[model samples]
Target: MITLNHYLFVSGALFALGLAGVVVRRNIIIIFMCLEMMLSAANLALVGFSRFRVTDGLPDYAAQSLVFFTITVAAAEVAVGLAVIVALYRTRQSVEVDTITRMRG
Candidate 1:
């Protein structure tokens, strides 16, 4: 039988992987994906906790509602991040982090 600890461990592992990707990758697109991964990991943990915390044999709706809100936020973030990335790519012709590091005035 799966337990809350198991869910939490998986969530932690996914978050770590996402964090590593964000730190090590130079491309903005990859970094964006990693950020989404981190969000997903958080959502999973929330759902797991909500599922385990039974109230009269029913999972808590509050956590699930929060998860929905989080999903909405993540979706919005992706749309905005992609737009920014596209603009950067058009101006620089590259999506690498180094291209954006040095500012031109």
Candidate 2:
């Protein structure tokens, strides 16, 4: 049978993968995707905990609410982040992090 620990383990693995991607990748778009992946992992862990934990016989709405808030923020971040990436690409024609560092504007 599946358990909370199992969910947590999976979440940890996903988070680790996202972290590795962020650390090892050079392209800004891939880094943004990794950041989203990390957010998704957090959401999964939050939902899993809300589903499995006992809360005095009450539904765990708090964690779900937090997840909702996180997703909303992440959405906004993605919109703004992609816009910035596009602008950078237009001006520099490259999405590489090292090249972007030399940007004057």
Model 2 agreement with the true structure over 1-105: per-residue lDDT tens digits = 998999999999999999999999999999999999999999999999899876899669999999999999999999999999999999999999988767486
Per-candidate clashes come to 0, 0
Q: Give model 2's clash tally.
A: 0
lDDT of 2 at 37: 96
Cα lDDT of model 1 by residue, 25-77, tens digit = 99889999999999999999999999999999999899999999999999999
Candidate 1 wrongly placed segments (more than 4 Å): 103-105
What would you estimate as the lDDT of candidate 2? 0.94
State in Å the error of residue 11, model 1.
Answer: 0.2
Candidate 2 wrongly placed segments (more than 4 Å): 56-58
User: CA lDDT of 16 in candidate 2?
Assistant: 100
Q: Mark the 10 consecutive residues where model 1 has the least summed lDDT.
A: 96-105
Query: Deviation in angstroms for 19 in model 2?
Result: 0.5
